[model samples]
Each structure stands twice: as structure tokens, then as C-alpha cells.
Target: MMRGFDSYASIVFFLIGIAFVWESRKISESSYGSNVGPDIFPMGLGAILVLLSIRLFYEAMKAPKGDSDGKTTPDYKRFLMIAGAAALYAYYLEDIGYVIGTFLFLLFCFQTIQRGKLVTSLVVSASFSYGVYYLFVQILEGTLPGFPSWLQ
Candidate 1:
């Protein structure tokens, strides 16, 4: 079952990588005077993904069949929770402000994955959210939603 799943995943990822590489060709070959183009990164990443997927396929094919007949139950509840949180995060990111939305989403995900260690999860989530905001807005001179307009 694991082997079959891996094989399917590899095929899917391989196709996705091929699509990325094909679409990347639509971008301009170079930017300004620089020889390296914006498309290069995506093309290169796609090639890497293709190679990795091929490797996965090879490993899956070579794997010995196990005798264990019992199938493991998937954690669908956890998956649904994380998926819902991610959807909400994407929807509310701009409206709620990056820092607050990201922090809440990360905190929720962390707690959902592991119930205990509330303080640690809070600290890590807060640090990541604020750190990204500071790095992008203050340090890099890039704009991100800082706080909701009503707060200002």
C-alpha cells in the first residue's frame, strides 16, 4: 500500500514539475542586464522536483513488500483541522493583518498538532509572525499589512 501510494505521488509530482518547467518558459529570458532570469529559478526548481520524484519512484519500486496485513488508519481529523486553518489564514491574511493572522493560525496549528506546551507554542508562533513582519517591512523595505486600519 505504501509503495502504491508513493508511486502515485511520484507520478503526480513529476507531472506538476513538468508543468512548472513548461510554464516558466513563458517568462522573459533575462532581467535587465543580468543573464540570470526570473524563469531560471522556477525552471531549476522544477527540474529538481522532477529528479526527486523519479528517485521516489525508483525507491518505491525497489521496496520489498511487507507481510503486515493490518492497514493503518489515517489521521483525517488532524488533516481537516489543518486544512481549515490554512484556508482561513489565506482568506483573512490581508484583512486581519499579517502578524495577527499568521500568529493565530500558527498557534492554532501548533496546538492542534500537539495539545500541550501552550507557552512554547505561543512564543514560537508570536516570534515567527513578528519576525517575518519585521524582516519584510522594516529590514527589507517591503510592504506587508502591519495591523488592521481600525487599530491605526
Candidate 2:
């Protein structure tokens, strides 16, 4: 089971690395000043992820096999719940706006999937969503979704 988890994590990292590498190619050097290009960070991070994945894969391969002692299997229901919440978030992101969608996502994650306290989950989710919104919209001056004219 441990080895399986390691293998899965390694493969995920490997795929992420590949994605980063592919994305890096799209960033043109001319887009950035002579100092640095957008591709540089992506390529560097991709290489690091690839190296880490390789190391993890090797370690997992060398790890000892499972013991005779019985071990409990992972909770598939919980996994499904988390996956469902993520899917919901992705589906509603554009319609609900980032802040509201993210808050609802976090609340669902903490309350339904993680089984956290109601008050704690609500507070944390609201704070995190607001913080992210403020950072992106106010500090970074990034465009965010606004109420649609029709909705107004």
C-alpha cells in the first residue's frame, strides 16, 4: 500500500513536470526583459520535479514489501467526496466567481470530506477565500469575475 502510494505520487509529479515543460515552451524570451524570461522558472521547476519524481520512484522500488500484518484499505467514499467537491468547484468557478466558488469548495472540503467542525470550517473557508481574493484583486490588480450585467 505504501509503495503504491509512492508510485502514484511519483507518477503525478512526473506528469506535472511534463506539463510544466510543455507550458514553458509557450513563453517567449522577448516577453520578459533581458534579465529573465517566464520560461526560466517553469523549466527550472519542471526539471526539479522530474528529478524528485525519479528519486521517489527509485526509493519506492527499493522499499520492503508489505508485512504479513493486516492493514486497512483507504476510504474510497472519502476520496469520492473530495473528488466530487473538486469537480463542483471547477464546474462553478466561472459562474459563481472565484471568491464564492472557492469558499464553497473549501467549506465542502472541510465539512463533508474532512468532517471538520462547522464553525471552524466556515471561518477558515471564508477567511481563506477572502484572503485569496484580496491578494489577487487588490494587491496584484488581477482581473476577477464581477456580477454579470444580466444578473444585476
Candidate 3:
């Protein structure tokens, strides 16, 4: 069951990655007065996604045969919660701003995946969200919502 699910998920992710890469190509390269291109992030993400999906497929294929006792069940509730968080993050990204939205989303996901370790989750989430924000806004000169107006 796990093997079948992994294979199917990997294929889906692979297609999504391909689509991302393809669509990114249509974006005009380089923002005005900036050396970094708008498409760089998406393209890089797409590439990473493709590579990881391939790896997932390999892992699924290499998994040893196991007895499929009907006792094991997939955690649909957890999956749905994470999916909803992801959707909200995407929908309100501009409104909530990148740093805040990403931090909250990542934190939620990390905690959902493994409960406890609040400090570690907070540190990692803060680091990733702020790090990416800085990379794009400061270094790359790409536009991303930094903070909501109320936070100013």
C-alpha cells in the first residue's frame, strides 16, 4: 500500500515539477534594474522537485516486499490539515507577507509531521522564512511581500 501510494505520488509530483519548469520559462527574465530573474526561484524549485520525485520513485521501487496486513491505514486527516494550510498560505501570501506566512505554514507543517520540539521547529521555520525573504528582497532584488501594512 505504501509502495503504491509513493509511486503514484511521485508521478504526480514529477508532472507538477515539469509544469512549473515549463511555465517558468514563459516569465520575462530579470526584473527591471535587477540582475536576478523572476523565473529563477520557480525554475530552481521545479528542478529540485523533479529530482526529489525521481528519488522518491527510486526509493519506492527499492522498498522490500512487506506483508500487507489490512491494519495499516493512511492518515488522511493529517494530510488534509496540511493541505489546507498550504492552500491558505498560497491564498493569503500577499496579504500576510512572505516571512509571516511562510513561517506559520512551515511551523504548522513541521509540528504536524512530528509533535514537540517547539524550539527546533521555531528556529528552523524562522530561519527558512527570513532567510528566503532576505535572499529575494535584499540580495536578488526580487519583489516579495515583506510585511503587512499593520506590521510596519
- The local distance difference test score of each candidate is 0.87, 0.78, 0.91
RMSD of 1: 5.0
TM-score of 3: 0.84
What order do you get sorting by lDDT, best first? 3, 1, 2
Predicted candidate 3, C-alpha RMSD: 2.7
lDDT of 3: 0.91
Q: Across residues 1-152, which tens digit of lDDT does each residue of candidate 1 receive? A: 45667788899999999998999999998676444567877998899999999999898888778722236767899999999999999999889999999999999999999999999999999999999888766775556677999888
> lDDT at 68 for candidate 3?
33
Better of 2 and 3 by lDDT: 3
Off by over 4 Å in 2: 28-70, 147-152
User: lDDT tens digits, residues 1-152, model 3?
Assistant: 45667788899999999999999999998778777888898999999999999999898888777723344898999999999999999999999999999999999999999999999999999999999999978987778887999989
Name the candidate that leads on TM-score: 3
Check candidate 2 and list the clashing pairs.
Answer: none
Q: Write down the lDDT that model 1 would get.
A: 0.87
